[model samples]
Target: MTQSPYVLVLFYSRHGSVSEMAKHIARGINKVNGMEAMIRQVPDVSDTTKMASPALPENGSPYCTLEELAGCSGLAIGSPSYFGSMAAPLKHFIDQTSTLWMTGQLIDKPACGFTSASTMHGGQEQCIHSMMTPLLHHGMLWLGLPYKNKELISTQSGGTPYGASHLANSTYEISLTSDEKVLCEAQGKRLAETALKLKK
Candidate 1:
């Protein structure tokens, strides 16, 4: 039997906020008829001097495979902002997609980015942009939360035209603002819908 077309919601969440956003995005993708969300996570990487993640993750989604990335109808990349860019693990996974790039496997696929930050000004947009760079280089059509999302205008927390985002403000822990969740869902729905149309 054929598998349903899915939008890959791939992310790296060190502190859990980005993972929450990924779930919300997956919820939105499921709302679209005939589309599904395939949520996956990248394992943390470290240099030889540092310890690496175990072969299996301790929690959350399993590590993503290249075949899954190549087969997806759409893609959403999520990560926590790390000094104005995406976290290292996400970059590491993205860096591995050059084989897909060389094969043109992901060309024309609809794609989007999402991010979280510990502070309000912690470079959410920059992190999303950093995620987008690789997708663009892969020839994927980039999608973003449009102004029509209204959350983009009304949000006091995290939302942007470049992509979905969240302000975690974690002194103790991280969480999404209501507006951030709405925009994330909107971004997911947009990507799924566009991907369906393009698949036809």
Candidate 2:
């Protein structure tokens, strides 16, 4: 049977913030009529990752397969900020997509990024850009929240034109503020709308 069209929500979370954002994004994608969201997580990586990390996670979504990734009509990538860039484990998974790139599998697909940071100024925009570069290399069309989204102006915590974001530690916890969550949902909705338009 043919699979229904879905926007792959692929992400990595360390403190659970990014994963939560993926859920919100998926909710937004499901708002579209003919599109859906496929949530997946990348495996953790360490110096001894291959032998040290389990093939399956102890909880949450399973590791993303190349087949799921290549089949998606759209993508929403999320990661936690590490210094001023994406977390290493997510970066490692992105690096492995060379095979997909060579085959042009993701070309013309709509993609967006979201991120979480431990602080208000923890390089959130830069981290989102780090995720965007690889998607650009894969020939995917990128999407970002526009100024038209009122939350982009009223947000006191985290949300950016580059993509959805969250101040993961505002309450000494990993919750997204109201405005941040709104933007995330808006980004997902927009990505879904764009992907459906392009697929035509």
lDDT of each: 0.90, 0.91
In angstroms, give how far residue 195 of model 2 lies from its true place. 0.4
lDDT score for residue 135 of model 1: 89
Report clash pairs, candidate 1.
none
Candidate 1: tens digits of C-alpha lDDT, residues 1-200: 99889999999988788899999999999999989999999988886523378888898998899999999999999998899899888888888888999999999999999988878899988888899888899999999888988889888888989999888768335678889888889999999999999999
Tens digits of per-residue lDDT, candidate 2, 1-200, equal: 99999999999987788998999999899999999999999988878645245899899998998999999999999998888799888888888899999999999999999998878889999999999999999999999999999999998888999999998654347777889778889999999999999999
Candidate 2 TM-score over all chains jointly: 0.96
- Range of the 10 consecutive residues with the lowest summed lDDT in candidate 1: 43-52
- After aligning candidate 2 to the native by TM-score, how far in Å is the CA of 99 from where it should be? 1.2
Model 2 CA deviation exceeding 4 Å by range: 49-51, 170-172
TM-scores for every predicted model? 0.96, 0.96
lDDT of 2 at 190: 98
Candidate 1 accuracy as TM-score: 0.96
